[model samples]
Target: SIWCLKSKNVPTSGCTFYTRHFLCFSVDSPSRQDDEHKLIARYTTRLPLTLILHIINFDANKQKRELIAQLESKNREILAEIKRLRAEHDAVCQPSPEKGSTNPTLLAELRLLRQRKDELEQRMSSLQESRRELMVQLEGLMKLLKDEEQRQAVSSYPFLGNTETVGFSPY
Candidate 1:
């Protein structure tokens, strides 16, 4: 189902060996087909069958080298990206005067504002409590004024309390 292209012979030890130099191709069926019946050609070669094994090993080694190279490239890219991100983080988190404004001044201003806000809130709460107490006192004073007016009116009309003047005109 698989086939190699170029062939070169190399002498090793006491025998000649063939080295594979081209890419392999896969075939579902043979390149040539007979008209009468399916005549599939069996692959034949002058070189030893061990040449196929050597070719397969070479291809595997080449693929392994390529994968290692790609992995190394990706690792370098990731390391560079990490370095860039760390720099950006430092730039944002660590403020300097050269970057624009003074950090200590800004922090001090923020603290002062927060303290002022707290003081104002406390003062407002005290004022609200004082207002409530004043309102209660005002209500008590109003009730006292109404009772005194009623007493004065009853004293000024003393003859209205006499029940014996039913048929007498004492005007």
Candidate 2:
């Protein structure tokens, strides 16, 4: 059993006090102690620190998937915009009987369209680089987390023998 206490004012006499009791268990009983120890051992063996690392890895994988989807959507949008711009430029460049010549305004608009397309291409390249960097970082973090979990598992179970003495250096 476990008990919890909550109070607004701090105790000044260096004496501890308990309030708002939630649970009470008799730890004086040897049977209870044995049961608690058995429970701890069972739980630790079945779900060790490695489980935490697995959960983190799963989350990272999910994020990567989401990022890929977003990147694809963005690329589609950029492509559509470029197509629309090209159509508009073509419409402006159509020959007019009144002028029967290339208009300066149409030429400037075409130049602007080309500039926008180039900018979009540069942005796409940057996004690709960012995605690659994120993946590399995620891989490194997972590896470090795995190594830490293995170290924790070995430390938790003493009966498995001293990992360091056995030449099993986690580092």
| Model 1 bad stretches (over 4 Å) | 1-102, 160-171
* Model number with the top TM-score: 2
Alpha-carbon local distance difference test for all models: 0.67, 0.70
User: Which stretch of 10 consecutive residues in model 2 shows the poorest summed lDDT?
Assistant: 3-12
TM-score list, all predictions: 0.35, 0.38
Write the residue-wise lDDT of candidate 1 on 22-93 in tens digits: 334354545423311211122234556798789989999999999999999999999999999999999877
Residue pairs in clash, model 2 = none
User: Across residues 1-171, which tens digit of lDDT does each residue of candidate 2 receive?
Assistant: 442222323222333455552223354655666655555565555565788688889999999999999999999999999999999888657656554445778668778999999999999999999999999999999999998988778778775556557777544
Deviation of model 2 at 124, angstroms: 1.1
Error of 2 at 7 (Å): 99
Error of 1 at 155 (Å): 1.0
